[model samples]
Target chain A: MKTTPLAALHESLGARMLPFAGWEMPIQYQGIVAEHKAVRESVGIFDISHMGQFYASGNSVADWLNSLLTNDTGKLGDGEGQYTLLLNEKGGVIDDMIIYRISADEFFLVVNAARIDEDWAWFQKHCPADITLRNESDHFAGVAVQGPKAKAAWKAVFPDCDLPEKNGILEKDDWVVCRTGYTGEDGFEFFSPADQIETWFQNFLDAGAQPCGLGARDSLRLEKCFPLNGSDLNESNTPLEAGLGFFVKLDKGCDFTGSDVLQKQKSKGLKQKLVALKATGKGPPPRGGYDIALPGGEIIGQLTSGGQSPVLACGIGMAYVPIELADLGTEIEVVVRDRRYPLEVVKKPFV
Target chain B: MNVPDHLKYTESHEWIDGSEVVTVGISDHAQEELTDVVYLELPEIGRTVKKGEAIAVIESVKAANDIYAPVSGEIVEINEPLGEAPEPVNNDPFGDGWMFKIKTSNASEIDELLNADAYRQLIS
Candidate 1:
């Protein structure tokens, strides 16, 4: 049970604590559905301190990173970030990350909490002599202030420091702010020294931001069809299979790790794809690992992430099925607790 | 944490009223803990179940919860509307949120359940 820098603050607020990614993170404060609705309609703040942070700098840092990650670092301007993936030799996703070009010769990466050690280890094993890599996961705490009013919340806290534009990063003394979030809302991620994160979290709350938890965060992202690294993505699945091929650049003028396999998969046609599913009839909400079957009860795959959408008031989820059965409007049944429920394959961004 | 004096409770958080044919529902403390009640499944009207057996299920936004049989009995009726909209489970767990009614096979089994005071202490 690793604790975040603001563990005590979460406890004081009557948050339901749960173990996630090896951290005793808050599952909810007021309630998951209430907190979820708060983020969709208003502003909500979340503790994202458990995620990993890394800094890389070198003479040809852009080229070096392009050789290691799926997205081309050359495409990023200074202070710009893009969604990207790190892949193993077989094109299986190691982790999905947001890599930013801090400057011409430097870059910063934010990665999943559970993959911190593994991502850091992968970077170390492939480090070229020219590049300097630093794992700063233990030194920083992060918060995501999200929703339509996110900018107002940010303005209330750091009025002197202008918030960056979308997918942009701005760094100050011992702190960094990025216009990024998984909730599909207007938001920014604030990363500061671990000791000062509590103060910053409180400031946002004082500015009328609702303090949310991981439960709401999961539902919010799922509603938007954001693929969680360990759930929709895995060691055996490629980003291409997860419908994240937009981030993998095969024609970036240089080949990177797992690029060859991705090129092959692209040319030969994909075998499976991650697609969204919605319950067609009323029943229990679809959840992860629930079997997805044809109308006749032939199992094809299982849901990777799912829950009832608070906004839509219907069961929604994502699943990886064979490409043949992954088209929009494909009829599927999700077996929940030994009984099949009517489900339909649908388009993403379910909200 | 509201435990009505007339209702009997189980450690699993179900509440029962009546002696022969009882109305069963989840406790307030239970519903409060399992917030955001989304959807639920009720056992068939004629299904017989044993005491402490998981006979029904409730799904919240976070996870699914099993609703157990308070005593060995046959289910006489189910709250079917909950299968569509489950907000009542969180809003009014004891009244409209009542899950089912059972015809007790053994009346003596009801005596072993907790009273309002004991249920309160169990949650606290």
Candidate 2:
């Protein structure tokens, strides 16, 4: 299995190791709940080096990106980024990504770790001869330092460098910093050369950032209602149905890969909707594949992503249910083992 | 790693003490491996089971692990407090963390369990 540069460090710190998306990664350090609370209360650092990075540059790079991604690239000024989706011809999400316009003719795209190979192949297959796209997945190591204390920690490490505003990117010789993160907290993501990432990680640790793992990362992101690709998102569901229509600009005046299907779906209507669910009573944490039901106890669907909310002290999850039953405050039930528990359709960001 | 000298262990990491009314709990190694004990689903008292039957569940933050019956018998008691506060499983797996007490139907099953030394080697 592939391992990150901090494998030895994680072992030394006695982190619980698990296999995720074919990578041997640290699932938790001190503990999942503790690390999660650290990120919520103070500062925490996570190794996101496994995610794929691509640099695209050309005289017409903006137009090329606009032709493929769902978000409108024409609105992105230099140093700005936005959450976007790459869709198939059927309007199904292939992979969600963040593309940052580095310059008028250059952009940097960060894709999901599990979708690296497929995304690279898709980009290469669609690239124009004049446009240059370079895959830099293995060249960089990523660290996301997040929490209320994140700005103070970043200041401690780079006293002279001013942090970019929200959704902003900053480029240096060996490091690229972005004011973005999965957790709904104030933070910045720093990407540096693979060999030099350890130094940055250690520096963040010294600046009082607790080392977190995938477990806490998932919990934090779930609390914020961020859809995880390959789980809450897949190639079968359109962005409009997944409650991500904000990222899909149908009125951009340009056609993307799935623009036609998206237009038709908008004109028609969504049959299913992705909505958040929270357990109303005590029970075992609702997990993925647990069956969900309607108000009358008719089984409808299975949860795509579910877990115990370390902050909320209950089970929370997301699932695609019939549009009529997706309204907030709709009473529902999620079956754990053989018994069902009270579940309610809730607003995004369960916290 | 802390395999108590007096406790007999099962291959699944549970520890049983006393032959007639045995107190059962997970080993220290098991709790350490399952960090952040968040929630637990305990079996009802008076439930009778056979050897190796899964009777309860222990949930960490991310996953659920089953707690099996080492020897078939009737469950006379359970760690009811764990429903609200499960950290004792991680803090004191052998003492305050005991899951249940089973009144064994066959005392011979006790001899089939591994001794402290043998259980230590299984984990090692």
Candidate 3:
């Protein structure tokens, strides 16, 4: 398995390591719940170095991205980033990504770790020859500093560097700091040279940022209703069905991939929708592949992600259900291990 | 790591420490492995359970695990406090975090359980 630059540091800190997206990554350090609480209450740092990064630079970069991504890349100014999705010809999601507009001609993209190779291949097949597409996944390392105290933690570590505004990217020589995160908090993601990542991680730790892991990352993101690439999204699912229509630009006037399908889907309502659920009674926490049913026990769908919310102190999850059952306060049942758990469709950000 | 010398252990990582109405709980090593116990489904009181049968379910943030009965017995009482707050199971597995008490006629089964030294070796 592939190891991040900070693999040794995680091992030295006694982090429980596991295989994720072909990389041996830390699943937890102190504990998943404790690490999760740290991020929600104070500051926590995550080694997200295994994610993929790419550089696209050319005179036609904006137009190229505008045609490839579902979001309006043409509107992005320098130092601005947008959450976008790469869609296939059928409007199915290829991958969800963050596009950072560094300059008029230079842009950067951070994509899911597991889809790096596929995303790179897709870019190569469609990118114009004038646009220089370089996969820098091996050379860069990323660490997300997240929580209410994230800015203060970063200031302590990098006193002279200015923190970027929300969805903004600040480039300082070799380092790129972006005000973005999966956890719904005011945080920054730092991308640096691979070799210097461990030093940066140590500096953050010394500055009082608790070290978190993938387990906490999952819980934090799920609490915010952020979709996981493999579970909540796949090649067969579209952004519209995933409740991510906000990221799709159907009327951008550019003939981009999946525009026709999304435009049609927008006009006609969706058949099914991803909705957030909260357990209404005491039961086992729901998990992926668990059956979703009506009160009468008729199966409706399956959960994409589910767990006990550390912050909410209740079971929370997301599942795809019929459009009629997607309304808030709609009662449902989640079958976990042959037993049914009562749940209600509620709003997002369970915390 | 905290295997009390007075307690007996099972290969599945449960610990028992009593004569007739024995107190049962998971070992420190088991709790450490299942960090941050979030929810638990304990067997009902007076439920008859056979040895090696799954009598409870313990959930952590990442996954769920089945907790087995170490000996054939009837559950006399369960840890009521655990249903509301299970962190003690991770914090003090050998002390106030006992899961339940089983009234059993098979006192000879206690002798079959591993001692502290043997349990430590099994984990190590």
Candidate 4:
């Protein structure tokens, strides 16, 4: 298994290590709930170095990217980043990513950890010969500093560096700092050389940022209703059905992969939609493969990801349900073992 | 991890104290591993349970674990406050976080369980 540059530091901090996306990574430092609360109330740092990074540079980079991704890359100004999806011919999402426009001809992409090889192969197949596509997944490390006090924490570490605005990217030396995160908080993701990542992580810790891990990361993202790549999204599912249509550009003037299918689905509407479900009564928290049913016990769907929401203090999860049953406030049941617990379809970002 | 000297423990991480109506709860080591207890499902009063049978369900932030009965008995009472708030199981697993009381006259069964030193060795 791959280990991040800061794996030693994580061990020194007594983090519980677990295997994630082919990497041996820390799952929690103190505990998931405590680290989760630190991110919500103060500041927390996550070593996300396991994720994939790539650089695309060429004269026709914007035009090529616009045709390759679901979002309109032509709309991204320099120093801007947009959440986009890479889809297959059938409009099924291959991976979701944040594409940063560094300059007129240079763009940086961050893809999911497990999909790096697949995404690389896909890019190579369609990329123009003149375009320079470099996969820098092994050379760099990434860390996310998140929470209400994230800006203050950053200021303490890099006093002279100005934090970027929301969805903005700032290039400094070999690092690319972006104002984006999976957790619903004011935070920044720093991409730096692997050798210097430990120093940066330590500096953030000295600045009062709690060291967190993947366990907290999952809970925090789920609370914000952010769809995970493998759990809530896959090649078998489209962005529209996953409730991520806002990021898909149907009429961007370029026919990117899956555009036609997505356009048709948008116009005709969807048969099933991903909806957030909150446990209404105290019971075992819904988990993946748990059955979603009506009060009469007819199964409709299954949870993609489910767990106890540390902030909400109750069980929360996401599941794909029929369009009619996806409405907010709709009552449902989640079957755990032989018993069914009352659940309700509600809006996202349960926190 | 705290393991009360007077309490009898099971290899599965449960503790039983008192004689006739024994108070039962998970050990501190078990609570530490299952961080941040969120919800629990307690067995109903008057429910008859066999030794080693799962009598309760505990849900932490990441996963859920079953709590087994330390010995055969009828459940006399359950910690009602845990239904609304389960943090005590993480905060005070030995005291305020006691799960249920089982009415059993089987002193020999209790003696068969591990003592504090034996339980500590099992966990280590």
Candidate 5:
């Protein structure tokens, strides 16, 4: 199995290691609960170098980007980034991504780690003559310092590092800083050279940032009702159906892929939408694919992501429910461990 | 790593000792293997459990495991603190991490448990 620069560090710290995607990533360091609490209460550092990064540059970068993503690139100024999605002609999500416009002719695209090969191939096949795509996945490493105390911890490490002025990006030599994160918390993501990543990770730890693993990461993201790519959003899912239509630019006047189908769906209204639910009693967090039952005990939907909320002291989950039952405060039931527990539809942020 | 010399161990990885009644808990190795004990469903305090019967369920991050009864007996007491913070099993599995106490029907059943050296070899 592949390993990152921090592989030895994780082993030295007695991390529970597990195979993720293709890399042996740390599942937990001190413990999942401790790491989860640290991120929620103070600061936690995550090794995100396994995620794929790409640089798209050339004169046709703007037109090329406009042709590919569902969002309008015309509105993005230099040094700004936006969350967007790549869609197929059938309006299926190819990969949700973030686009960083570094300059008029240069942009940085960050895609999901599991979709590296597919996304790279798609960018290569669709590159316009005026633009070029460079795969920087192996050359760059990313680390995230996240939590309420993240800014303070990060400032101690890199005192000169410009605070994120806007959406998730800070400028450093050969490094890109962004205020974006999968966990619904205030934090900064540092993108730097692969070799220098270990140094940064140690620096963050020296500054008392707890080392968190994917286990804590999942709980944190689930607490925020954020969607995981494979479990929550897939090729069969559309942003409109997933309650992410705000990220789609159907009226941006750009003839991008999947625009027609998305516009048609928008006019007709969504049949299904992602909704957050909280379990009412003591029970395990609803697992993905667990049945969501109606008042009459009829199965209606299934959870895509679920976990115990360390902060909420109960089970919480996110799933696609039919539009009729998607209203906030709608009471429902979740079948977990062969038993049904009362649940209620709530707002997106379950925290 | 801290295997109390006074306590006997089972091959299934539980540790046992006798006070007025037999006290049972998972070994340190067991807790380390199942890191971050989130929720533990212990058996009823007065219920009689058979040896090797599933008496409790422990859930970690994404996995759930059945904790078998070490010796056939009536559970005299349960650890209520685990419901609020099961991490003690991860923090002090041999001491304050004791799961429950039971009145054994037969004292000879405790003799079947392995000694410290044998229990260490079983895990190693």
Candidate 6:
């Protein structure tokens, strides 16, 4: 398995390592609960180098990206980034990515590690001379500092470094800092040289930032009801059905590749939607692939993700159920280890 | 990491105290490995258990695990406190975190279990 530059540091900190999305990443240090609570209460840092990066240059870059992604790329100014989705011909989400506009003719795309090859090949298949795409995944290291006290810990290393207060972007030295995160916490994502990542990580840790792992990251995103690319949204699910329609710009008329099918789906309305559920009692945490049942004992949907939230102190999950049964306060059942537990469909934002 | 000298152990990582009532729970090493205990399901107090049968279920943050019986017995009492707060298993697995108390049907069954030193070598 490939290791990040902080592999030695993780081992020294007694982390439990596990293979994830093609890299050996720390699954937990101390423990998932302790690390998770630390992030919710204080600050946590994560090595996000396993994610893929792409550089798009040339004059046609913006126009080419505008036709490929679901969101409008023409609206992004220099040094701005927007969350978007690359969809298949059927309007199903192939991958979710952040498109960063580096200049009038250059852009940076950060995508899921598992979808890097597929996304790169898809981009190459439709490339024109006006756009030059290069896979730059190995050239940089990314670190995320999140939670309430994240800014304080990060400020110790680069006191003059100022992160964008909004979802825009800022350049710090040779690095890029963005004030956005998958976790529902105030944080900044730093993209710097691979050799310099460890130095800054240690600096933040020494300033009282906790070392979080994949486990805490998963829990944090789940609490925010953020859909993971493979788990909650996939090639078989449309962005509308996955509850990510807000990110898809249907009326912008950008002439994107998947615009026709997505517009049709939006007009026709979705059949199934992803909904959040809360367990009614203290029981075993629900798990993915568990069957969802109605009050009449009819199968309706299946769970995509479920766990006990250390921050919320309750059980929360995502499920794809029929639109009629997806309302808040709807009753449902989740089967765990051969026993069914009753649950209620709650409003979004499980936290 | 407490390994009670008087208790017996199993290769499956359970510890048993079989002098009178046979109290059983997971070993400290086992609990340490399954960190961040979240939810637990213990058998009813009057439930009869057979050797090697799963009597309780433990859920950590990562996954769920089954706790098997060390000897054939009837459960007499259970640590209900774990249902409210399961982190004690991570804090003190051998003492306050003991799972259940079982009244053994056959006292001779304890002889087949491994002692403290034997259990230490088994885990090692």
Q: What is the TM-score of chain B alone in each candidate?
A: 0.98, 0.98, 0.97, 0.97, 0.94, 0.94
What tens-digit string does per-residue lDDT give for candidate 3 at A1-351? 998999999989989999999999999999988999999899999999999999999999998999999999877989999999999999898899999999999999999999999999999999888999999999899899999999998989889887988999998888888899999988999999999999999999998899999999999999999999989987877899999988988878797888888888878979888899999987778887799999976998889999989888788999888899989999999997778889999987686
In candidate 6 chain B, what residue range of length 10 has the lowest lDDT sum? Answer: B16-25
lDDT of 3 at A168: 94
Top candidate, metric DockQ: 1
Candidate 4's TM-score:
0.94
Writing each residue's lDDT as its tens digit, candidate 4 over A15-123 gives 9888999999999878998999999999999999998999999999999998989888888889999999999999888899999999999999999999999999999
lDDT of 5 by residue, A1-351 (tens): 768778888888888889998898998888787898999999999988888899999987977898889888888888888889998888888889888888889998888888899999988998877788899899888888888888888789889765765464656778878878877777878878888888888888999899998888999998887778887888877888877877888777777888888888888988888888998777766677888899767898788888777778677888888888889999988886667888888887877
Per-residue C-alpha lDDT of model 1 across residues A1-351, encoded as one tens digit per residue: 799999999999989999999999999999988898888899999999999999999998899999989988878899999999999999998999999999999999999999999999999999999999999999999999999999999889888878988999999998999999989999999999999999999999998899999999999999999999889999888889899988989989999988999999999999999999998888789999899998976898889999989898889999999999988899999998888888888888898
Regions more than 4 Å wrong, model 4: B19-21, B103-108
Candidates ranked, most accurate by TM-score first:
1, 2, 3, 4, 6, 5
Q: Which runs of model 1 end up more than 4 angstroms from their true locations?
A: none
Instruction: Give lDDT: candidate 4, residue A173.
Output: 93
- For model 4 chain A, give the 10-residue run with minimal summed lDDT: A280-289
User: What lDDT tens digits, residue by residue, belong to model 6 across residues A1-351?
Assistant: 778878888899888899999899988888887777787889888888788888899987887888888888778888888999999998888899988887889988888878888999999998986678889788778888888988887677778766666566776677777777778888878778788888878888898888988988998889889888888888888888988888888777677767788788778888888999898987788877788898658777788888888877777899988999888888998877767888898888987
lDDT of 2 by residue, A1-351 (tens): 898998888898778788888788889988888999999999999989888899999999999889899999999999999999999999998999999999999999999999999899989999999999999999988999999999999999999999999999999887999999999999999999889988899999999999999999999999999999999999999999999999999888789999999999999999999999999988889998899987556899999999999999899999999999989999888888888888899999798
What are the clashing pairs of model 6?
none
| Local error of candidate 6 at residue A63 (angstroms) | 1.8
When only the first chain is scored, the TM-scores of the models are 0.99, 0.98, 0.98, 0.98, 0.95, 0.96
- Scoring model 1 with DockQ, what do you get? 0.89
TM-score of model 5's chain A? 0.95
| Preferred candidate (DockQ higher): 4 or 6 | 6
Scoring model 2 with DockQ, what do you get? 0.76
Which candidate comes out best when scored by TM-score?
Answer: 1
Model 3 / residue A113 / CA error / Å: 0.7
